[model samples]
Target: MPDLPDISNIPYLPSPARDMNWRDLNRFKSSDRGSDFYKTCLDYSQVLWRQRLPARAILCLDRAWGADLTGDEPILESWPLPYQALVYILQNAPTGVFLGNPRIHFQHYADRLGEPRLEQRKWRSWACWALSCKARPDFQSDPDHDVEEPSLEKIAQKLDQYGHIEETKLWKSILQAID
Candidate 1:
């Protein structure tokens, strides 16, 4: 196995997947030269690839979730790690998809998702915690898992409610909802 191509600009995988020892799923490590994940990314990508994709960019084939589960392509910019995991949980992956590891690069999601909103931080917490539970149940025992009380619908409704209230009065309602 001669040297493969570049990093493919694929997103990294967070360490939340069943304590599998988080790997830089996007980067090709020499140690991974014999791994199936590495080979599949290169093999399938080469077939569908057109004239030229950047040396650093490869077409992603591994999805965050299976096709039946993934929703729309995740709007992953600006969000924190837990939120990113939520999107992965909501949306099913295609034949292959790129999942980024937030611990390694927290800012990437925010950068890609775009500038944050004034209330973004408020609602995102509800989502992140719920998502973390679904994706990494290990965190259920963690103190920060604040989603024990509210149902997911209630959280979404709260987020929607925040979208309507004025910023001046928003804190009152948002705080109430979070509490």
Candidate 2:
């Protein structure tokens, strides 16, 4: 048999399905929700891993958790709760979305998303991890700019690249909800 492609590196799978208990769901609903936001943040982190966006995926995860070490305000402030959760998990997340320069990644997320209160140690740790990933001179930056501000067209394009008919339909549904 032909050598199988390494499947281990793929990230961001199992798209998010809006299925959480009322309590878990309510956390993102309130402004003073506290750690609940972090929980939701982690959940989205898992989703990014399944989706295969990896680096950008982790950026989404981190943005959700409120790390935003970077200075970008509009991306952070304008982020909806779901998107924020997605970004937060993306930040410190391992397993998928590996990127270089955790500090730069954190700063990039901050630049994309407005700054928020974050645990200093956790944020720094993630930054370190990101930097380690960046140390590899061979790592090329992601070509997809739309990952930051994903539009229907971008979603459709990505779906066409990696998704099946059902997945494409599901992405359309997600786009409708976001719109």
Candidate lDDT values, in order:
0.32, 0.40
* lDDT per residue (tens digit) for residues 8-41 in model 1: 2223322222222124344545344323443333
Which ranges of candidate 2 are over 4 A from the true structure? 1-30, 64-104, 107-115, 118-130, 133-179
Q: How close is candidate 2 to the true structure, as a TM-score?
A: 0.34
Model 1 TM-score is 0.28
* Model 2: per-residue Cα lDDT over 1-179, one tens digit each: 54433333222223346643335434455455344354455455554454444565555454344532232333323332233223233333444335544444543452344223433323332332333333332434344533343334544555455333343454344333431
**What's the lDDT of the predicted structure labeled candidate 2?**
0.40
TM-score for every candidate vs. truth?
A: 0.28, 0.34
